[model samples]
Target: MPQKFALKQYLPNSSRLVYGCMGLGGNWQRLPLTDGDIKQAHAVVETALEAGMTLFDHADIYTHGNAEETFSHLFKQNPALRSKMVLQTKCSIRFADEQHVGRYDQSKSYILKAVDASLKRLGTEYIDILLLHRPDALMEPEEVALAFEQLLKSGKVRHFGVSNMHSGQIKLLSRALEVPLIVNQLELSLLKHDWVDAGTTFNDDQSKTNRVLGDTIEHCRLENIQLQAWGSMANGLYTGAKIDSNRFNDKQNAALLATKELVTNLANLYGVGKEAIVLAWLLRHPAKIQPVIGTVNLDRIKACAQALTLELTREQWYQLYVTARGQALP
Candidate 1:
């Protein structure tokens, strides 16, 4: 029998894996998005659709908003393809350069204006999912709730969620909003499991600062908020780096090698690629994770989409985790 795609109640029953367009138009350093690049990105989306992958993820700050523009350009040229897919985008996180960064904005004015800008750029009236790009310390939950209410009423946005927020923040926002915050985009991978052992007295307080993965994962399940894994490939830390580099020191290199071996074995067994094994590792969790893959390469996109069918047994999943951590399971 053919494999079936898993669907979360929050998003329309689309593909199990979502294609992230952050790196499509250009890189993050405010590079110019060329016509050829745009065409290539369109081809990636077309290929994804042809493979039965329909969900596309984007954000206003991605490539300084040029990613959305590229998507809009492609959708305008191929209008029929728009209805066949589910479109999602993010807002907030203002930055002029790598140094001069602006604070997060979740006020009614910012949210309203941001959605309008996204709508114009996406060339669509309604976004399937709208997520706050990051947590704004000064965000007024009531104002955000009001803005979401208006968007829902105006048919501009259908669902809402957040990215890189703690459980407390998500809970606070839920208290003030009537709509369910359906998803939380987070950083999760075998090598980046700080959230898993965050509060277990690892080394020092500084290392524990960002270690809230367990809380965030558990809370999402309790709240029925889907967990979306961003940086699913660990920003190419596992695949592209040299094994002898200082960054991937002896211990880390050994872990990477072990992971590589496991990935290779699983890929051959599943008739997929190593990238698919990385994604399958995350999906094996009970968190109902949907990986947001950011690959401009069409082959990479197809490889990631194949992860939807690669299933890992419980013991194999734990073995990968142990290999990544360079230690036995606690």
Candidate 2:
């Protein structure tokens, strides 16, 4: 096995599993951080480090910026940790206020200001990777390129990336930038399987139902751009997170239950926890898709880390896929 992940192209010592900071801090409220929130943050950071998750994912809007603020406490406690970990964050998402409706902003000014705020909140001098959280329909590639160049030269950001963007969008944006977009994060998991469906469901009836459609995985693979899976665990639907069954239809419910059963069986066989089996399914893919796990629960974090060493066979990987899809391949 190689010593580093595909992300190593950009983040040399990055982990296969990124510790998502979306769940950090107590709440999205503007209130000050309570002692309980600080305690939980410390615990999750320590557990993530022990699990070999040295790369932390953050967004400026996570918890209304409280997540990054809370994470800064970790570095304050141990300044050395700043050097030990690679911190990746995002911007370009602005929530609606009284005067303006919520929207995406990729303008040069917005990108620059957002990074400055993220740096201050993270208490870090430089961001390992800065991703545009989402694409703005009105984004100008030249404008974004200018912002990225300034960020790089100013020593505020080391590398750049994008989230929730398709290949064409990334390609178009990259054309104007001096930097190679190093990462592309998307919603990919057993529960939300369209990342794989783009290849399988084409020229067939199943194509119509694919909402988040794109050949992004293939494009990223070909370009050697790291593909990070957000919502990789399906909010724990398959691994036993309590969810209201009301949201799923009959077929969806059946598939969820069936996938859960198969994951459990495999977990016992692999001698690891169910979380590991679930994540192992993602890691089994050739894309080397890094799973950004956001579970703040200590045991769950440890369970997910087990996937670092677990490798699912081809058959097992397909079994989990079909079961989660709620239908067999065409």
Candidate 3:
């Protein structure tokens, strides 16, 4: 018999794994952006729903808001699919150039306008989940609270969260906001294990740049906030790099080969793909991490769905961690 699906209560009781759609409509140049591409993207959404994925993730800055438009077009084509799934989109972070060099805005005016435009682009009555794509250094807690209250009252958004923020940031926002901030999406993977190492200090300044693993995860669990992991594949940093590739170095290549071997072995044991095993490692954490996967390929979507079923043993989990870090527990 198939194993029962595990669901985490993101809010009071709503549960979803949250599929990231950053590559779907937003990064059209990298993926496809035409009307035909939009139609094909819808098929992936359908497949995800069929496989039990109920939450769709997006951001306004993604492909300069083209992702939301693509989703809107899909909703227009199949109006009924709206009721079957939860829609989540993010705001903040404006870009002046296509290279995405600009400012992060949390001003009430920009947020309000951004949400209105997002709703219009999504062709939806309400966004099930809304997140601040990134924190603004100039954000006023009271102003954010007021904006969230207004949106909640107007039925424009049902829930709120943040992306790429720390515990102190979440605390600051929670103090003035009445609505519960249900999630924090960040980068987490075996290769990026700082979330698990909490208070441990790394001497290498370069490694320290990205190391916040242990404290962030612990704080989220204590606060009843879900950890949504993006770049779960480390942006394919370890997939496979040619020896001459810029990203490929002796140390990095060794770690990648080790991870590839571990993932392949687990995939065979679980009857899934290596990618699924990679994702499963994140799910295996006690912090209740829900991976936000961005894929335009249907086979990849199916593989991701299968990942929900693969379970890694404790030894196997640590093996990958040790191999990636080239060190055992301290």
Candidate 4:
């Protein structure tokens, strides 16, 4: 039997890369979007499409919901593009306002309302996937399941997933959900390095306090859940961003420099840009991780697309891992 919500079942043609919409609506402020913002967004959308990246990851709270609003312009101008795209947006993380503190919401009412608002903003009748932006500490699984049922039945959201959640939480929620959760988005990159550490550090002292994302990578893989990576480029830390050496200790500084050098060497060896090498690190994982990139630079976007074809050998992958880990693996 096939898994109901597996990535292949729903997004068979997903480019294994996602264009993050957080950077689409301009700066994080209350002001209205200017013409320049929409123009910039068009470049990202068009470039990403050209690169074969059809999934656009968004969130209800991204840029005060302006990100989805901005993206809707493209679909409005060309409705045909909607059929060619897979739109996934997140909800639940709320900003503080005059009446309430900023918080994570998983209440049934809030979930339904958020979807309606997001649908309106995106100008779409349905969302290919709706993810919870973050876990709610006071989440009630039964209520959330009810909301999911409504969304699924009404054809507002076709699929569901989450961000920043662990394996146990996913299991608890899945027991109540009618359809399987298909994705888990997280901060997985060479710079963060904790996702790899969490898997390798079990039974070692390093696992005691260092494991923030406990076995999530393994759990997602075992469950056949698609893992999408955010911050996968590490803010150009390993690629080309100028480092502030003063902020790191001597050990950290050495690791940073060594990793950057290795990335450059591999890029030249592979005949592709450095972005491909960094993204390929995540792609090399057996879990088929999809990286979400936010760069709008035309050349840089194409450079990132190259990762879809670049294959790093086992030796090179471990070499990058050990250098970034800053020490021998446990």
- The candidate maximizing TM-score is 2
lDDT of 2: 0.90
Best by lDDT: 2
User: How much is the lDDT of residue 256 in candidate 3?
Assistant: 73
Candidate 2 per-residue lDDT over residues 1-330, each given as its tens digit = 743556887677888899999998878877787778878989999999998999999999998888999877878888999998999999999999999999999999999999999999999999999999998999999999999999999999999999999999989998999999999999989888987888888888988877455678888998888999999888998788986789998888888899999999999999999999989988989899999998999999999999978789999999999889988899
TM-score of each prediction: 0.90, 0.98, 0.89, 0.95
Ranking by lDDT: 2, 4, 1, 3
Better of 2 and 4 by TM-score: 2
Instruction: Give the lDDT of residue 157 in candidate 4.
Output: 95
What C-alpha lDDT do the candidate models reach, one value each?
0.80, 0.90, 0.76, 0.88
* Candidate 1 structure quality by residue, lDDT tens digits, 1-330: 333322355555567778888887766776777897688878988888876778889998887778888888888798887888888899988775588867888889989999999999888889989999899989989999999999999999999989999899999999999988888888878777775556433565554455555477778878888778888876655554455556777888888888877778878888887788888888887776887887777777778777777679988887788788876643
**RMSD in Å for all candidates:** 3.1, 1.2, 3.4, 2.6
- Candidate ranking under TM-score, highest first, comes to 2, 4, 1, 3
Put down candidate 3 lDDT per residue, 1-330, tens digits, no spaces: 333222245433233456778877645354546877587668878878876777888888677677787877887888888888788899998876777668899989999999999999888999988999898999999999999999999999988889899888898999999888887888788767776655444455444545644366677778877778888866654443234446567877787777777777777788886668777788877776888777767777777777777678899887877787765555
- Model 3, runs deviating above 4 Å: 1-16, 26-33, 97-101, 199-214, 237-244
Candidate 3 Cα deviation (angstroms), residue 271: 2.0
